[model samples]
Target: MTLPTPSTEIRPDLVLLAGRVRTGLGSAADAAETDGTGRETLPFDAVAVRGRHIVAVARRADVDGWNTSAAEIIDLGESTITAGFVDAHVHPLSGAESRHNALMLHDCETTTEVAERIAAFAAERGPEEWIRGFGLSFDMFVGHEITNEPFARAFGGRPGYLLLFDGHSIIASPRALERAGIDGTRDFGNNSSIEVYADGTPTGYLIESDAESLVTDLYPRMPVEARVTAVQNKLAEFAASGYTSLHQMNMEEGDLDVLRALEESGELPVRVRVSPLWRASDPWAETLRRMIALQGVSGRRWHVEGVKFMLDGSIDNGSAWLFEADTHGGGLEPYWTPSAQFTHAIHALAESGVPTATHAIGDKAVEFVLDAVQSLPSHAANTRHRIEHVETIPDALVPRFAELGVTASMQPIHAFAQRADGCDMWTTLLGRDSERAANGWRIADLDRSGAIVALGSDWPVEEFDGRKIFAANVTRHRHGSDRPAVDPHQALSPERTLRALTRNGWASIGHPGEGVVAPGARADLAVFADDPLSTDPDRFAESRVLLTVVDGQVAHRDSSLA
Candidate 1:
């Protein structure tokens, strides 16, 4: 639990004192509340940062003796400081670009409201220009009312592409489909489909990337300059939320270029590790080769570190690769053409010293990925290959995660956002009996088995908020409702959850010591309104972020902190 000493004492760039700081010095404790009862805990009262690295983290008296009056001093006044959060899996660039021109519909509650909002947004677009919008929730189309008629009436026959909030499903206007040359007769394999009427006319609802790309590919994309500004705006949002680093998943070639430019210009507010996507249309070897080349393209603030593949679609759309279900005709489908392609790609990439992060939601998908990881050569055992969104881990496979050293990169907010009354789109598809065993996040179980677990918001799929993550992991309950906990047994202790967001997330992306606050570590810290360790776990949501510091520089400071 102790950090090594620095070679020499030197003046720091900044000093922070008068706070209860969680230095993130040790492995996660069994439970958050009863941690370090008998063990000697490290003292964390103040911290000193030199350049972009921490120089001292000890009691105030200890840190003060080494530093003179040259550094900028900040008195935290009983605030709490912890390692800045690391969101392991996020898609921020696209979502940030969407905010510039796309019609934001995440706030709408009812179908009528959504239609009304779409109508108003469509009224502003030209007849020929594509009307693009995003953030349409899954529940909005529960009755399958997101057909072409409302879209046609609203857009006045203009081509339009409205992406659902989850990025899995899309409902396009008839004109948009016609413009994209998409007819109902087009078949997109087993996992992906274009919903059509009995007479073979299209319903405008497309599932999975293959089907949705038909119209989205035709939509005019944001220009490079506009995209850069949007990304900058998004970085400000992340810094304000106390995030110091991000594991950017599902990045495109253009997105990579934009990130490089940002890093070169010193505009990046947080450190980024990007995972360029391996599209299904491309050959496995070709994609792996391109992704491997990108591993060398890295800067201090951003880098291409891994490859991302979607093994299956979201569960809400009945596209997830699940086991033989008693109902829903066995919900199982693989996004890759040849199922072996994933294993082959994972091996080739791992052999090149590049890790793979696959999106696997269902139990079968999870198991298949674990098998692929297990099949890797013994030399690649420490590759740290990850299974993104281990949403459902079969009881038998839970222990295998530790044995194989596969990181369970999960999104806890997903459980709170999707589930209601212990039932959600995922559970509704898999009957009640199967839901209990299958809709399991099983994060606590994964930790207990000695497996590494990292948590993230899976942003754009869910809002990015570190406070909500803490609350969600502790309760697994809805924010403002009396709905029962989604899965009480899956709830992790606050200490464990914090480790997942900080140390575990950083290590998963190949930076183990980065998220810890110690000598020779990056100086990224988050200051909260209350001491998280002393505060009640249930009241975590109420604690506000008072300030955020990255690279020993202040990124965000609430006026109240002054």
Candidate 2:
């Protein structure tokens, strides 16, 4: 397909030539007209950017149509260029600090390894300060009992916390739990729990959001200056990986202030749209007022215009609010008590013109969120409320996503992390037989139902690598796991996956018309070493990001590109 020529000559700030630009073809039906390849092939080979907006997209030799001499021209040599990726869901400050400074336990496979890593971390810190780290997977203690005894010994009485890879669980040192004054006596309601032994003693493992907060709230956070630097570094890392925008989920007031400082200082490297977390316990009216006040803060590259709420917990941790109990007998735990409180929160957010992105994973939680949105007054139809991580849903509820204008914000890497193989934690949690697949992310099913799908890596929960997400979306398997494809039929095409990763990501974050490379659109482009549109999943790891442009400025460029 081709675009019409501009009526007058244009002067651009930058001109990229000889590139295979994957201009996002509109929707599923538009892609249907293609040769079943799941994308429309645009004929453009060059893009002209003029001060944060694309001025023209046309053939490589058509540079004369614009003021070529005024623009900084770069010959891409037939490289692949797409709209810079927009990660729809991320925890910027927490994930950034963890990635750079946290004592990593990502390589550990057993409790012994976890203990050794913690011990080493404590030794380096001299047992005086709190030890914070992440990246312990579920398989580490699949059949074995979970114990913090070794963790306590390693910490040598100093406080320490080791968060599971899922972020829904945490293992605390015994001293930390003691300092928190959390005996096995207090009830954490249904949504959160402090794991206890047979005789009613705390086990040091805290599950779900509330339980994890017990230890986390006491652990001193990084100073504001340090956190700001960490987030800045993380943004640089993201730009280097080709991300131009990030939808920061669950930002606290402090975090928002830090981000604002960065933006004001002209240090932010990418566009950030944030949703201040909505705490249910706060009075609804006050909560709305606070969010409204926060929403007023906006900048050229940073904005706060949405609210985030959690409805349920992770499925693998048995906190998912499923309609049916799993084979091991666990199901249905809403974060908000009485469930109506949760519904009320969503309705209020929508009515107030603030879009909401909820964390709901189970079929029941998904259905409940949809029902809440459905009950909104007719005029609230444009709410664009989203359901984050629609991991499990019945066939009947899939179409309602489009019918009600709810975006399905999903993480493709999650399905890859938890394959349908009998060995994964999800399979064991659900006890999936041959008739059922436990690792159903339903991307294809949702697409077939005409739903808008936005993709992201939950970040600290998983490695937030765009190529890994691409590899997972196309292969339906983990990056290095030897397991077979979970359900290969659910695998998406490269074009569709790219759209979800880029354009759909913007839509999910309440920013529309910003994900494509076209006239009047934001000049956010990602340059790759090869044509990912035609590449296989196996070769995705070989494709490198050569450059990333945000708002007509070079945010990240490989040294070789110079």
Model 2: number of clashes? 0
C-alpha lDDT (0 to 100) for residue 83 of candidate 2: 92
Q: How many residue pairs clash in each candidate?
A: 0, 0
Question: What lDDT score belongs to each candidate, Candidate 1 first?
Answer: 0.77, 0.79
Error of 1 at 176 (Å): 0.9
Clashing pairs for model 2 are none
Off by over 4 Å in 1: 1-4, 27-42, 140-146, 149-151, 417-423, 435-438, 536-539
The sequence of per-residue lDDT tens digits that candidate 1 reaches over residues 52-73 is: 8888776676764675568888
Consecutive 10-residue window with the lowest summed lDDT within model 1 = 27-36
Best by TM-score: 2
Q: Each model's TM-score, in the order given? A: 0.91, 0.93
